[model samples]
Structure formats: structure tokens, C-alpha cells
Target: MRFKLRPSDDAFYEFFSKAAANLVRGTELLNELALPGADVQSISERLVEVEHDSDAITHELYNKINTSFITPFDREDIYRLGSQLDDIMDHLEGVGSLLYLYGLTKLPSLPREVHEMVNVLDQQAKLTADAMPRLKSMKDLREYWVECNRLENEGDRVYRMLLVRLFSGEYDALTVLKMKEVADELEAACDAFEHVANTVETIAVKES
Candidate 1:
């Protein structure tokens, strides 16, 4: 251990960020069933896999946050950041679970559109992770975070349009409901990402 080392606050942000990236990858993997031979089994199996991955990262980050003597922001912010980042993975897990529970043997192209939104969420997570260190300079990166918010807003737009398309579709009520549930979760995950961005921005202001 070096004496008088600088505190590394971004670890809290970075660990959860791996958690976030896996969440998007998990969604994309499942959504790949939008093609052939992709069924409920694939979704369920992937869900379990991602759940284990996400949970491990969350626990590790939580431990790091609690044990570390230094963080750039308040302890509560650290906790909130970890939880919110983990939440995106949780939402993706929910989507996979719903696929199994709803008995959706086949995937649809429309949900793929929302999956595209996950890519936006991916960018949000990256921006957030990048911006946390910016807390060291987060003041200078407020506009950078605002851009992440814009991505979240775009996610909101995609969710709304997906819902509209779901209702307009020829699918049955249960199908519509399942689609709605998936979209809600994806949208909520994106919202949670925005919350992380907002938290980062706030921390930047207070620290600066």
C-alpha cells in the first residue's frame, strides 16, 4: 500500500458500468431471438446468466463503496449509483422472465426497436461512467450529461411509439400486455440511467 494515495471514487461508477453494459448485451442476446429457432428457452437461460453476472458486480461494487475510505461523492450517492446501475440489469432480467412467463415462443420485430433503444442506454451508461471521473471535472461536463439526458428522452420517445404500435397490432390482449410490460421495463431502465446522470451532475455541482 502506497502512503497518501489519492482516492479513486470512479470505481463505484465503473463497476456498476460493467453491470450496465452486460444488461444491454443481455437484451441484445435475447432480442436476437427476433430471428429463427430463438424461443423461450434461450431467453430464460440468458436471463439466469445475466442475473448472476449483474448481481456479482453489484455486490462487489457495494462492498467496495462501503469499505473504501474515499469516494468523490457522498456515501448515499455511491449507494444510489450502484443500485440504479444494477436496476438496469434487473429490468432486463424482468424482460427475459416475462418472455418465459408470458409463453412467448417467438420474438417480434417491434421489440427489436426498443432493443435499439438499449444501445442508446448503452451510450448513457458509458457517458455516465465517463462523467463520474468528470466529477473531478463534472462541472465542465454538464452539457455532456445533458446529452445523456437527451438520449434518455429519445428512449422515452421510442417506448411511447412502441406502445402505440403494440396497441395497433393484430396481437391479442395478453400479447399486448406482455409487450407493454417489456417496454415499460426498458423505459424504466433508461430512466434509471438518467437518474444516474442527474446524480453525477448534482455531485459535480456540489463538489465544484
Candidate 2:
């Protein structure tokens, strides 16, 4: 193990935790837009604000990385974790953008599978946020990454089912295309969360 003479900066952890909180807000707003008679434009506006806030947090994190001589974990891990978290928010914002751009009046009673996928995104964001504070000790963090892997796997199965239904003559070709786009964004968001969890696990192992 490489020993550090200087104390590592811990501000990155606080930034990460703040970013995760913003991500949860983004997902929650996206999920709200999925409800009946939801104001898609208004919710998208709110998400835009959340996305901007997250971008600011990300900028601060990278600035910290560049200035600090010592980091709480590996430098590349810091970059990847911050980038993945930003991607999750970006995709959540994409979901809202698609709703408005597609002129979808209301998400037709989304299949249970699709709802489950959104639920997983919400849970994953909150779990990641909760785990960020534990980075100091790197203790009891295995469950977070393990749960992330399981949720990503579950999201994959649901995504496949969604595609099959999209092509099964249940929706017109145009409608199928639009719904598929939304599903793609949601799946990408879940994948982003999994990537964050993987990075955290790697950092923990190295630090431990």
C-alpha cells in the first residue's frame, strides 16, 4: 500500500453525497411525470434546474480533484464516480424531455415491468446517497454494490420484456418508437447507477 504523508481531502465525499441527492430529486420528478395528467413541461423545467445544479456539483468535485494533492480514493475512481452520477441525472432529464418532445399526453398505463424499473432507479439513487457518507471507513458497503448489481440485472429483464411488447402489435409503429425511447433512457439511468456502484466497490476494495 502506498502511504500518504498528507491527510487526504474529504470534501469530495460531501460533493458526492450532494450529487446523489440531486439525482434522487431528478428521478423522483421523472417518476412524477409518469403519473396521469402530470404536467410534463413543468416537471421537465424542474428537472432542468436539478440537472443544472448537479452539473455545478460535478464541476466543484473536479475542481477539488485538480487542486488537492491527496484524495480520499484513487483519482480515476473519483472521476468515474462523478461522471457516472452525472450521467444518471442526464438520463433522468432525458426521460422528461422525451415526454414533452413526443407530445405524449399521458404515459399509457405503463406495464408493471416498466414501473418496477423506475422504482429500482429511485431506490438505487437513495441507496447510493446513503452510502456516500460511509466512504470514510469503507465499512459495511458491500451490500450497496451487491444490491446495485441485482437491481441492474432485474432492470435488464424488464427492459427486454418492454421491447418485446413494444414490437408485439400492441402499439402502432410510431408509438412503439416513442415508448422505446423512454424505456431506453430509463434503462440507461439504471445502468449509470450500476456503474457508480461498481466504481464505489472498486474504490472500497483498494482502500481496504
**Predicted structure with the largest lDDT when compared to the true one:** 2
TM-score of each: 0.77, 0.93
lDDT of each: 0.71, 0.86
Q: Give lDDT tens digits, candidate 1, residues 1-208.
A: 4242446566765775577567657656656644456666766787779878888988998788778887756888777777876777787677667666776645444455666766776677667655555454345677767998899989988888788778886678878888788778778878887887787777666665
Model 2, 102-193: lDDT tens digits are 87646557656567778889888889989988887788999999998898998888899888888889878898889889899989998999
Candidate 1 Cα lDDT to native: 0.71
RMSD of each: 4.3, 1.8
Q: Could you tell me the lDDT of residue 84 within candidate 1?
A: 75
Candidate 1: pairs in clash? 134-137, 134-138
Off by over 4 Å in 2: 1-8
